[model samples]
Structure formats: structure tokens, C-alpha cells
Target chain A: MELTRRDAAAALAALGAGGAVGYAAHEWGSGGDDSPDAPDDGLATDEEVRDALVAVAEVVYPSAVSGIAAFVESFLAGRLEREDHGRGVRETVGELDELASEWYDGPVAELDPEDRDRLLREVGADVADENPEGTTAERVRYYVVNELLLALYASPRGGELVGIENPQGHPGGTDTYQRGTP
Target chain B: MSGPATNRARNRAVDRTPVDGADVCVIGAGPAGGLVAARLADAGYDVVVLDAGPRFDPGDRQERMERAIRPAYDRPDVWGVGGERDAHAATGEWFYPLNHARVKGVGGSTLHWQGMVMRLHEADFNSRSERGVGVDWPIDYADLRPYYAEAERELGVAGADDNPFGPPREEPYPMPAFPPSYSDSLFAAACEELGISMHSVGNARNSETYDGRSECVGYGTCQPVCPSGAKYDATVHVERAEQAGATVIDRAPVQYLEHSADAVRAAEYATPDGETHRQEAEAFVVACGGVETPRLLLLSESEEYPGGLANASGLVGKFFMDHLFAGTGGVLDEPTRQNHVGFITSESHQFYDEADAEVGPFKLEFFNYAGPSPVELALTGDDWGDALLERLNAEYGDHVAVGALVEQLPREDSYVALDPERTDHLDSPVPDVHWNVGDRALETIERANQVQEQILDELGAEVTWQAGPDSTGPAYHHMGTTRMGNDPEESVVDPQCRTHDLDNCWIAGSSVFPTGGAMNPTLTIAALALRVAEDIERSL
Candidate 1:
């Protein structure tokens, strides 16, 4: 039948029980959050991406129960390796981490939730202004955030958490679905 | 000298059946062919659609991309016969030669299309009355409005209920337009500030489920193929036709139409394995797109009609048209580019209907996406490495772009003929497309650009760069090769899409577009196909 969050979680659990997962299939923007380039254990296992993810995810989505940082980190790192000629979404992620580090001496996870929220707003503005002399920071941030939004709104688990419907009959419909100010 | 068997003797025949034997034979399977096959089959006709290419799947995107990059875009790959010139071949990501005219298996080129579905403005029909140029259409906007509505429903367009400048319609759109992407939002805000009214673009992309399909995933991969069935493609219609009873013969390249007494009797084709086959029918419909339709007519020349059947007007492949597009981008004060993912969610047609004495009124479609790929972005800007990347990170959020797609009024001089030296598979002549924009076209573009520059300035975007020469590339909206007219002397097909002088022969697709408007062509193509199908059913 149609794939759901429970099925994906069960798949994730099975993979966890079996040790590391392999890059068998990827439903990054939908049903499954499996990374095409990940080691397959679970999510965001890349060190550089983990650090960046910890910084930004903690700021934007700090429910802790949501596990937003780990999920986003895994998604970003996976997409970075495969997209845009392997340079990665490094600049945008790096900007987030550097900002978080500047604001808090310790890891972003150690920051108080209030400060984390404030840091997210601050970093959002910073990344949005990244560069203009060449490609422009606004363009870079747009690309990165757009990818991130896709990961959040398009993935199965993300869809469940956000109350979005299953994209049955066509999995690519999420791209065309009109979203409110979420 | 050459009766049916004698003509058969000239080339080793595949199906040696004489004239008037088969049920239905469809020539070419692009948008029109695909849709016709599906509809006729659904209506209980034993339709046999002949296409030149093989079918494709979305998973084959990489292979498709490789082919596109290595050969298709830069050379004479897809045009069939000699096909059109390679000047406008470099459309990024959506480039594929074999599938250009009539994609092989199912969806046709809708598999690889950007789902823009705009209805032609009212002025599109009566060009002479409005623009003081081009011939007025045999049909008017009112005549086509019902078909437009039907086509929109069938195609599942996502557009606003209000279309102030468009033709009056029966009902509102089935679903609302797609929301504004961040880039679109920025442009909207900027345009609003500039007193330019922006509306969400009417896209063929499904906003909500209508038929048995799902919505779009906003993958930005509108070209090549939509693995997801969110976008409307002709294959979907073709598939529907197959389920109903149409027999699609993939890889059957139609060579020419076989006719007698001005009635199409059969279609000659080369199978994938090189066997020549002829499928005879009581009636023949040629839906081989603009370039191929004309090529087929030219190749099917008989002594009775030396200049080509229905080409007594000498206009079988005359008056080709394409929307010429130019893009200009600048940095706005707001964080516009950071959210490039949904860029192009909205547009402003304010400039489209405004009165202008010299060039007439032209249309403008503002882009909602971040400008270019990283490599392209790098080339556009003078920076590299972390610094360059850093700049991309910052400025992507502040960029707003406006792209203009202007209608190049039809001129008979702009035409597609077979190139003598260039031969393609099946030994067909290459389509020698010779199109040079007239003075009015240039003036139209300049006026649009001037307005866009003003809008960007008003939005406080420091205009950085514009993409185009004094002129721009003829856009992907290819149209009007074998246009329809009231008189047989001036056109290849009649208003019913039946070939003039050839009673049982018919044609379809944008090739039948009498006048190319500034709007995207898919909606119009769909409407025309629907209209032609009705006529065919009536004829039956």
C-alpha cells in the first residue's frame, strides 16, 4: 500500500537493529528520509554536517522531541555530497554554525532554548545576506533554505509532523502544493 | 506510372494494403497525437498512433541529461529530417532531441515540459485590429474560450479565479494558483511597491487532485520528466486512450501521407527495425508537430499537387513563431533569494495589456526562482571559492528577477523548409528554420525591459545584470509552422484542422496556431486538440 511514517519508522528500526543501512533507495523529499550518500545507520552521521546541523537545527526547531537537528543535518549532508558539484551547501551551513559558535561558547545544543530561537532569527538574517558581489548571499540562502524546506515539508516524517497529506497518485505533487505562511 | 502497388513497389512495403482499408491512422504523437490517440480510443476508435521516438521514465533522467548535455542541445538531434536550426537549441535541462516533436512512448514532451498553462489574451486573435500587424485569426478569442475552459479542466490548471484581461470564461479554475515562492514573494512585494499587479501564474501543475492524479512536489525539475504525475503530460491522456482501446505503435517513424482524390488513404512509416510499413485508413490525422507536419506535406508531393498537397497557398510550413525571452535580475533590500526553491510562484501581467503605440501591448512573466546554477551564477558574477560561495549565500536572499516572454508577430518570411544538405534518420530533410525578429518585436522587448527596469528600481533592487544581446533567443514556446486558416490558398489546414485539398487528412498541435501570443502555448494546444477531436468525431 501507500508508505506512511509508521512504515518508515519501522524501516528505520529494522535498519538500526541490523546495524548500518545501505543506500538502497532515497525518498529524501518524500516518504523516506534515507540519504543517498549516508552510511545508512540512521541520519546525519557526517562530522562537518553534524556540527552545522547542531548549530542551525537547535535554533530553528528546538523541540528536542522533534529531533529536528539530527534529521536536518542528515538530510543536508546527504544532499550536499550529491548536489551542486560536491562543494556542498557548506557556505550556508558554515554560516549558521559560525554564528551559533559566536553567540554561544559551547555547542549549540548547550544553549538555552530562548537563546537558540533568537540565534535562529539572527543567523537567518545573516545567511540571507551572505554575498552579493558575485552570486549574492540572498540567492545562496534561497537555495539552501529551499532545499531545507523541501526536506522538512516533503519527507514522510516531516509530512506527518506538519499535518500534510500523503502525495498519493503522484509523489511529486508536494512541489506544486500551495503552502500557507508556515 | 505509379498506382497503389506501383507506389508500394517503389519502396518495400510494410503493410501492402491498398487505399481505404484500415480504421484509424494517427501520424506523429507529440502533444496532439498523444492526446488524439487517447481521446479517440476512449471514444471507441481503433486508433493506431505512429511515433518516431521510444518511451521514457523519470528514473532515466541522468541518461537523458547526459544525452542532452553531450549532443542534443548543441547539434541537430531531435528536429527530424533536417529539423530547425540549432540556434535556439540550448534550453537547459529540458533539452532532448528524439523526444522533441513526438516523444516515443506515452506522455510525449509533456513528460519534459515546464507546466505553464496560460490562455492567450483576447488581442491574440484579432492582431490586425489590436496590433496593426499579422493576419487576424479565422477564429476569435470568444470562439476559443469554451475550449480554453475545457482544456484547463482537462489539463488541471492551477490559476486564480480572476483574469481581468483574459477572455470571459464559463467557470473559475478548478483549483487556486500555486502560492508565491520566496523569490516570487519578493518580486510581488517589489512589483506592488512599483504599482505593478502580480498574480499567481496559471500552471498546468496540479494544485489539488482533479482527475486520478496527485499534486506536484515542486521539484523544480519541470523539464526532462516529472516522475511524479503532478504535471499534465500528453502521455497521461495517451495512456487513458490506450486503456480505452488505442493501439500506439512506438518507434514508427511516418515518412509521408498516402492520399487519393484529396483524401488521405494511408500513412507510410519505418519501423524500429528498418521495415517500411504502410497503414491504410479511411481517414488520416497528421499530428507530427510544426516542423514534421510541414516536412510530411512536402515529402508527400504528387504530380496532381506538385507544390505539395494543401500547399496551393505555398504556406504549409510558413509563419513559424516562438516567444523570445530575456531575463534581468537585481538585488532587492529584502531577503529575496534565500528562498529560491519556490521562486516563480507568482507573476504580473500588468504590462501585457497596457497600450503602447509602437510595439502594441506585450506580456511579462516575472521569475520566482534564484538566478542560474552555481556554475552559471559564478559565470554571471566575478567571484570564486569560499568568498564566492559566501556571496552566493548572502545575495541569493536579496535577488529578484523579471523575465519577459514577448510574442513575435507572425511573418511568412519566418518559416521552416527542408535543408538540402542536412539529412536525418529515414533520409528526411532537416527543418531549415529561418526566423529573424522584425522591428516591432525588438521594440516590444525594449518597452517590456524598460518597464521591468523601472519596477526593479522601484523595488529598491540594485539592478546588477541583464541576460540578452540587443536581441534574445526565440523561447521554447515553438508554434505556427502549419497554421490554420479559413481559406485553403493561405493555409495548410482549415479551421477544423483538416488539411485543405486533402479531405480526410487532419493536423494538430501548436503548428496550427495562426498567431503566437505572448502566453505559454500548452493551454492553447490542449484547447485546439480538444476542438479538433470534436470535429473528427463529428466527421465520423
Candidate 2:
């Protein structure tokens, strides 16, 4: 999948259905803020980036779980609220959308399901080739999918996928060590 | 030696009419101050202990952890430096950064301590005699042995007495050792296979209630806060000091000591509100940790004592030292599932005698880490979505961080001095420190790193995170700022930790440590404080 300047829409329909959070599209990647002086506003809201992420999450966390758009939007909004590197993250999300739009000839958030999957696989292959060690992709996918997975997997609902008895940092009894192997 | 029992540690105000009955004044109610103050008051001395930080109730452990971990406000400003709203100084420029590694409060730094309590080895006391580097401690391990035992009992240390590498002890730990964490069992099996012996570290956490405190509820946030009093914090002794008739005052940072020709007459302290109060005492014990103790002495400059109150030998704030801290370890195939028991569950002193004076000795606080934090998960981890979750599930907790806390030789160049220009809220000089990882320590760190790798390899783990010599930072084991020795010219305190320059002043903490071995420093600090209180009681 050598797809780099390449890489999001089922995300918007879901957002329109969920109305999880508000946003202005294209705030992050547009700032070109991968510098020390970059504002810690990497999580600034971007409708287009949010839409792209939901589409990516759909491909990433495939299931009949219909709220990918709302989850991604809520997670990005929280990042903008808490972390300094957030605005840069929002920027990367915008970049991801640009790549997807360029490749598919349509907004990623507005793409057909099969096209969205194909675009994600191509981006994944390119990210793997470019960042064999994985750090660059982590940054590239910070707002798009990776961080969303962390927030999701660390939740009681999502933690069920792993053998995790309790979400990390939560106060739970020790005797409840995971009963079965994943 | 008795009067109205007051606990200004929370919000109780001191009467303006300089409270007169206090026979001894102890500053900084941390592990050092708490033990000494309690001992003195128990001996019926009418002690008055002053802590610059606010008195934190153990009940607020959850709230404090929430506030402490945030980017905006860390733990409450127990350092007497500033409040939560005030931004902390960027200390990255310093030789070593404390960066929330130390805390200030009624319990002092113990509020943030992980409680890996252990006594310095017998060989640690006479390092100069054994290896010929730093000055030897004026007193030997024999002198502190009884105090160490008593301290373990008083603080409720839990562990077996069978660590082959541990120094001979008079008694077993006050409580049976905490059940080994899952990581401990795996690491122990690994060490056994490699012909290396591992010991459960003597922890100040409780197994069952010996004191009025409850057993461990196992919330797993033991570093800065323990929701259950299962883990020991110095605040327990602050209340005990009050019960023993000592007046415990909080937010009272001692500004200076009033002294006559060769004796300290009273301690002058400032309230957070800018009000000043003086407590007259027969003698004064400075138990402020390594940093603030020297800061206090250096700030107390007078015409007679030009260098500082305890600087007749010009050695009040020299020979500062901290553990030579660095991490060396690897990632394993299966999760160790460690965080359940506690941080620093086990350590070994097998390498304590490996080097003579030319290189520092060290101990390994060994355990499987809880694994890469949420941030690390995203950065270095592969895949996304379901694959991401699958990868994290497989690799997240499968890691260990064998951090070595190596002994440091005291050098005069690395010291704590008052900044000439910078001042705190009370206009007292802010402490400016210069720390250099000694060239000798580099040799020790290299060997320690090698040992760390050996452990990881023995555990059949693949090496991942390796910290080089330059990456070593503070371990919070502050010591030797006010070096203790027999010679007045070469040391600040005598064998009893009293200032050689002054008759009625003394110190109680690792600040008086002449040569710090690779122990955690809390047990030894508490032992020394108890010893100092004994001496002060005799003088009284």
C-alpha cells in the first residue's frame, strides 16, 4: 500500500446521526505545525478531519458498531481540551483527509465502504514502508485512528476484547486478574 | 514537657505570643522529621515540629492524585516554593530535575515515596576505609543497627529477613512480606535460572493492620498517593508526634535560626500569609530533606556566622549527592502483570560489594513494569484499530524496567547553594544546585547497566529501552548535602548529626549522610533521625 500524500466519509453520516460534537473542518494539518514553536493546539476541531477519522475508524475497528463517527469526534474534542500536541494532531487528521480525497476523488468521509477500506489499506502499507519503526505513523495517525483505539480499548466496553478485567488506572480489586487468556 | 495539644498542620493557627513550652524544635515533618519529632515527644520533650507544606489527610489521596498528575497543577506546593496556581520552575537546566519526583507536605516527601525501605549495608558506613573514596560515616553500622530495627518496627516494614544480600538484622520485619506481584514470580524464576538470588524488598506497606490503619485495598497508585493507609506515609507519625504532645504546624517554613556565640536559641519561621513567628527551644533539629535542609542553613547568614549558621567549617552545604539513577531492561513475550502489588516490589544488593572505592556500588529495584503508557502505546506500537488492540494486548504489559540506584561519591563541586538573585515568596533565596555525575560513577553505571541486561536476558526477554550514562537522572534519594564526619573542617555534622559549629543545633536526615550506598535512603534517614533524637534527648 505505498499510498504517503494519500489517505475519510460513512464518518459524516454517523456524525449527522449522532451529533456528538461541533467542529470547523481543516484546522490542524493546514497549520503545518510540526515544530517546537507549534501551538499545543493540535487537537483543534476540524469537521473534515473528524469525518475522515470516523471513516478510517470504521475500516480499522470493523464491526456493526455504528457510532464510529461520534466516537472519533468525541475523542478528538477531548484531545483538543487536554493535550498540548492536540492542534498538530488535528492538522495530521486534515492531512489524512487530503490524502484520501486526492486518492478517491471524493471526501473520505463521503466515500463508499469498499473504497474507504481500499484507501486505508493503501495508506497502511505506505505508513508501514515509511515508518518501519512506527513512530512517524503514530504521529500521522494520532487523531485518525491510533489514539482512538487507545481511548476505546481502555474503556470498560472496549476492554472486553482484551483479557483486561479493568481499564488501566481504574481502582479495582487485585484478585480479579484476567480469568482467561486472550 | 506537656501543654495544649495543637495541630496547626491542617489550619490551626499558632498563638502570636511565641509559644514557649516547646523544648525542641524540629523542621520538616517528613520521614526524617516525623520519626525524630515523635521520638523526642515520646521521650517527653514538648517538641514543636514545623512543616512548610500543608497537612494532607490520607482521605484525600484520590483528589490529590487527580490534581498531582495534571499538567496544570502537580502535587500541592509542599516545597514552600509556591502554590498550585504558580507554575513550577523549569528545572531541566539543572544537573538533575526533581520534576515532581519529590513532594512537600506534612508527611514531606514520603507523601510521594514508594516505600522501598532498607538499611545501608555495613560496608556502606566505612566506604572510605574499604574503598578509599568518599569520607567514612563517623558512626558505623553497629551504631545504627538497633535504631534500624526499631525504625522498621515503628514504621511497619514488611519482608522476610532472609535476603542473602541484605545486611544482618536483629529481627524479622514487623509484618510478613507482601505477596509477590505476578511480575515478581516471573522475575524470581528467571533469576533462579540464571543463578542470581532476588529478595522481596522490605516495604513500609502493611500486610495486615498493626497500627490503626487498614490493609491494602490494592488500588495500585502507591507512588504519590495510596488511597488506603496500607502503605506507610510520614503523616502518620506527624499525628503521632501530636499525640505524644508535640505541636505540629503546617505551612511554616523556617526562615532562619537565631544563634548566640555557639548555640542556636530559637527558630524563626514564616507563615504563608507573610506573618512571622519564633519558637524558642533548648535545641533545634533540621530534618528538612537534603534540599531544603541546606537551603535553610545557607539562608540563615549572620554577622557572626558569615557562611551560614552551621558553616564554621565552611562545609554546611557541600558534598551533595543523589543516587546514580538509570534504567536497563527488556520486553518479554507475556505480560508480567506487575502493577497490582506495588512499585519497587523487589531489589537485590548482590552488586553492593562488587567495586572498591574507585567505583560506586548499587542495588537493582527489579520488577516487570506496568508497561508502556498510553502515549508510548500509540507512538511505538504497530497497526491500528482491531490490530492495534490485538498488538497492545499481546505486548503492552510484557516489559520490565530494572532501574539501578547506584551509590554516588560525594564531591564538593556538586552542592546546594542559595541563588544570589532568585528568591521565593518569603524573599528567601531559592536553592541553586550544581550536580555532576562523577566520573567514578560512570564506571559503576556501566556495570549496573550490564547487570540489568543480564537479568533481562536471563528472563528470556528482548532488550528494548536502554538508558545511557547521560540519560541517568534523579532517584529522589537526596543525601550528603551536610556531610557528617569527625573532623569539623571536613564535615558539617558530628557522629550525632549535630552541627559542629553550634552546640544546640543538629540535623536529622540523609542530609548528614557522608557516603550514601545504593539503598532507597528512607529507612536510613529514619534511623538517623531516631539516633539524633536520642542524642538531643540526652542533651535536654
Candidate 3:
């Protein structure tokens, strides 16, 4: 239960073993970016991304199951080739990993549950100050975490999945009634 | 019976005969040709107006169908160019190409425009006055204001009295302001917190049924074509002229404006079926938008007026203007999303009037709303890898977007000329546009960004990454090509919208606007058309 920098680092280092636990490390560490059509070399893979998403979602919303991870993985996979778009997420994930090593001395997925929650709480303010200069990743990471929670807990589908009352009101479909380029 | 009845009968007999004839004939339509044709027809002359654009009818199916099927490039929808390279024009709507300029069939480009009318601020009229930047407008805003009011009632705009920015006017708007949408309230609340004032944009759309048109339905699709008759386009004016016994021909494109010694004698148009028609008139008017109007004049060079008719100043195809737009979006702590449908609900004009306090200000207006769908939002991303998409969907709702329209100073450098190489499907030379932002233009944008950031913070919204520091795109408010001016040396058209070199020819649309103020350009375009309409009436 005592999560520390050494524990997270050891867990991340053992990811290449190709087992259930190793799958998380493989997914988070080497996002499957190897493709002839791949626009970039550092993109994440479905399996590896799924593993990491599941790990993050558990800490973000502990009660959810395999759903959020699948959603995030599929969504990310679909945007691999869109220029001016994919860079934000890539930068954010890369920055997240870097911050994990700085704060916890290890991979983010290896942190204990209590420490993981603490990291999430502090990230809101900390990520805002990261600046990222020429990249959009840090901003993407900050945005994505807040959005995932809002969607998972506040959306209609999310409402049916879990019991968090979406206080934002009018789940979906209504706001989209006549929206077009104005 | 002996005096009045006999005179009427004689007038009718004369009308029965072809009153006037010209070499090149323009058909009846909207603002594009209507304004020009009317002026020519009134000049003790013979100009034929063959307009076939959809006539405004309250809930008329034939009108709707006509607007829907009119091809902009005059091609079938299935033949449209597709893919990411042309995604901005993904679906060519019924009447015209999405943004190709013109409503196709008739009244030209003004058929479905929301008449949010305001002249370019004085600085806009004279970019060179204070900034010493950009070319001076052939005409100033003060000169255009009288005409702006004349055009206001002609098009019937809805606005409040005494505008917060710029010069004072004699008459108030015909109708009150259009109601603010739910999004407007939210944005207003945020603006208030940031000490910025938001105003209801003056729209040419009828707030409550005026000038024989029905009230507005706030239909989201105001561009391309409006299903509601609330919008005052050129078609209405064309219809009025036709009702007064003007003959309108449809499906004909004027190819040339034949001029002789500073007088346009005729306009030549090619019919859709490939027939050349010649009608002779005493005078001619060129109401085509900035690009096409000048193009026709240039294309019609004869032995008489070389280097294009009415090109004595050599300024016909110069000074093209389109307001630059950049979008900013972020998430708010409170849920203020409502009435997501409607055109612009509110505008931040607080910065508009005070734009050029020191070196002379330029116009900048702030507009925003919720966000587009996931498919559309994908276009806003900077990264293209797999991880990017996932993050996008995950972060969709945590944001609201603000679009800032920055007015550019009129410069000869930013012009729309015939491209040396690029041609349209019709083998005609496509317009090659070169628009660049100067140091002052960039300064206006930076100031807009600062205002946006302050407003976002006041709205209790969390900031996201800003999209525009260097990137700028056309907001589709094209203006200033055949500009009106005091001196004929620098302008193609005179203050009354008459060609400086051509005594009988007149021009309309944003082409006459010297500077592009931050407000939408359509209203001013409509106003100018109306002012020219009054001038045409007087000369007769």
C-alpha cells in the first residue's frame, strides 16, 4: 500500500514482460506508433493505450470498468493521421509520463491509489503552468482529464453506467438541435 | 380623361415597344446587376434587366427550389470537388457555391445576407489618415453615412439608436435589435465580469415583419440561403423594380461593360444555353461584387477604353479586403449553455469605437458560442496521431469558443487580381488573392486575444491553448476593390458609386468600402446599394 518512486519505477520497467500487468507498461511506455501510414513515430497502440487508459480511469473514477479505456483508445487510434491535431495529445501523454517520474520517481500507472488521486488533484493547477511553448500536449493533458471525468460522470451514457447525477443538465441531443457554422 | 388618361395610354404604348437597347444586356436579379441596371435604365437610356434569381415569397416552394438547385459554378452538386483539401467547401448548398460569391440565379450575393449594417469606421474609410498604413479609401465613412441611412430603410435593418461606436447618425434603425440567444446571455455575463460591454448586433433581418417581408425565425443557416423571408437580400429590390415594369432575364452572365468616352453604353451577357444577346442602353451600371464587377470592366477592353474600361486610375482590381478571424475556446465552471441555435446573438463592440485612440485604431469584434460536433471539432486540433483523437473527444465539452474578427487596413498589397495560372472549371481566370496582415493588423489581433483571455477568466471558464498567433483566415466579409473616393486619381468609382472615368456606370457591394471595420460587411454593402438606388432615382 505504501506507494513510492521506486515502486512505480520498478512496475513501469517490468512492462515489457507481455503479461496482464506487463500489458499496462507496454501500452503506456511504447504506444503502438509503428505503421506505414502513421503520420508520426511516437503514437500509442490500442492494446498498450487500453491498458494505460484502464489504469488511469481506475484512479480517476475508480468505480468504472473497461468502458472508459476502450472509448479513449478507439478515439485516439482514429486521429493518428490528422496534422495540427494529434500533436496535443501526444505532447500531453509524453509530458504526463515526464511529470510522473519527477513527482513519484516512476510511471504514473505504478503509483498507489491514494498517491494517484493526490497527483490528479495537484495536476489541475500544475499543468496549467507548464506552458509547453511550441507544443500543445500539456494543455491537451489538462483538458483531457477534466473532460473524461465530466463526460463519464455527466453524460447520459455515463449516467446509465454510473450513478453520478449530471448536474450540468440536459444530457445530449437538445444542444445540438440546429447547431451549424454561424 | 382627355389629359391624364391620354398621357397614360401614350406612356403604355411606348413601354410596349423596346424602350432602350444596348450591346451587352444584363438580366434582372438582385443587388449585383439590379443596382447597375436600374441606373443605366434611368439615364434616358436602354438597359434590359433580365433577372431570374429566386424572388422572395413568404413560404414559396418554387423560390426555395430555385435557390436550392442554383449551381454557383453552374455545375451539378454531384460534380463538386471533395476531400480534406476542399473540406471548407464540403457541401455546395443549393443556390451558389458555399462561399464562391454571388447568390447565382439573380440578385447576386446579397440574396440571403443578414443586413448588420455599419460603415467602416473613419479609420476604415481612410486607413492612411491616422496610421499612415494601407491606402486611403477613395471615399470616407462620413461620406458613406448619409448613404448608409438611405440604404438602412431600403433594406430595413433592426438596430438601436445612437451606436456606441464611431460617428452619430440622423435616423435610427428601422427596427429594434434582434433578440440575443441563450449563448449570448452566457457570453454577456462573462463580458460584464471582464468589464467589456456586449451589444446586440444590428441586423438587416426584420425583427417583426417590415417592407412586405415576414418576421425572422432565427434559422441557423443565414448564409447560403435563408428559408425565412426575414433576411433582406437584393432579390427583394430586384422584385420591386420588376413590379414597376422592369423586364428581368435569368441565367445570363454579363461578360463585358462596353463603354465610350467615360460612358458605359451596354453590358453583354452570355446566356446559360450559350447564346450571345445584345441589348443597347444609353447608360450602364456595374453592380457586380468587387471582383466580378472589375473583372467584367477589364475583360471588355475595346479600341476606345484600353487597359479595361473605367481603369483610368488603374485601381479597379486593387485593395481587396476580408476581415481576419481567429477562434478561442475553453471550459466554464458553470453550465450556461442554452439556445444554441441562431446566428450571432451578441457582439462585443466595446473595443470597436475606441480601436485607434493613439496611432488611430482598427476594428475588432468578439463573437462565440458552445462548440461544433466531434467530427467538426477534429479540424481544430494541432496533432494528427492516434492519441490526439482520443484526447479530443475526451476534452470536447470542457470548452466554449470565441471568434474574433479583425479589420484590416485597406492596402494595395492585399488585392484580388486575376491569377496568372489558376483557372476555374469554365476556363476563366480565377481570382488570385494576396492578403497579408501588417504590424498594425497583428497588433489589433493581439489586443483581441488579450480581451478574449480576460473575458474567459471572468466567465469562470478554464483557459485552453490559443489557436491563432500567426494564423488568420477569411471571415468571408470581402470588401473594397472598386472603391468610391473624392479624387478620381486614386479611385475607380466616385462618392455616389459612379465610375470615375465612366459617367454612366455605378458600382455597389463591399467593393466601395475603403476600410473593413470589424462589423459584418453585408449591411454596409446593402446600404451602399440603397444609396446608389436613391442616386439613380434622382438622375432620372
Q: Of the candidates shown, which would achieve the greatest lDDT relative to the real structure?
A: 2
Residue B225 lDDT in model 2? 69
Question: What interface RMSD does every candidate have?
Answer: 12.7, 8.5, 16.6
Give per-residue CA lDDT, model 3, range B1-540, as digits (tens): 023465455534432222354422443355645654554444433446653232333333212322232211121221122222112211111111334444444655555454556655655665566655556665566766776786677778887754466467787788887655545666667777676666666677777889888776533335545555677777676666555455666545566665678677656655534555555665455665655666667677788767777888888767776666655667765443322323554665567655562322433333333553332232233332233345544644434667677776667776656655655434455554555545666677777777777777777777775646476556656678787778888887877887888765667677777667676776567666666656665664
C-alpha lDDT of residue B342 in model 3: 32
Q: What is the TM-score of chain B alone in each candidate?
A: 0.86, 0.91, 0.78
The regions of model 2 sitting more than 4 angstroms off are: A1-161, A166-168, A173-182, B1-17, B67-94, B373-391
lDDT of 1: 0.59
Cα error of candidate 1 at position A83, Å? 20
What would the per-residue lDDT of candidate 2 be over residues B208-259, giving only the tens digit for each residue?
7878987765545576667667788888888898998889877787899888
- Provide fnat values for all models in the order shown: 0.09, 0.19, 0.02
**In model 1 chain A, which range of ten residues has the least summed lDDT?**
A14-23
lDDT of 1 at A90: 47
Better of 1 and 3 by DockQ: 1
Q: Candidate 2: lDDT of B141?
A: 91
Question: How well does each candidate superpose onto the true structure, as a TM-score?
Answer: 0.70, 0.75, 0.62
What TM-score would candidate 3 get against the native? Answer: 0.62
TM-score of chain B of 3: 0.78
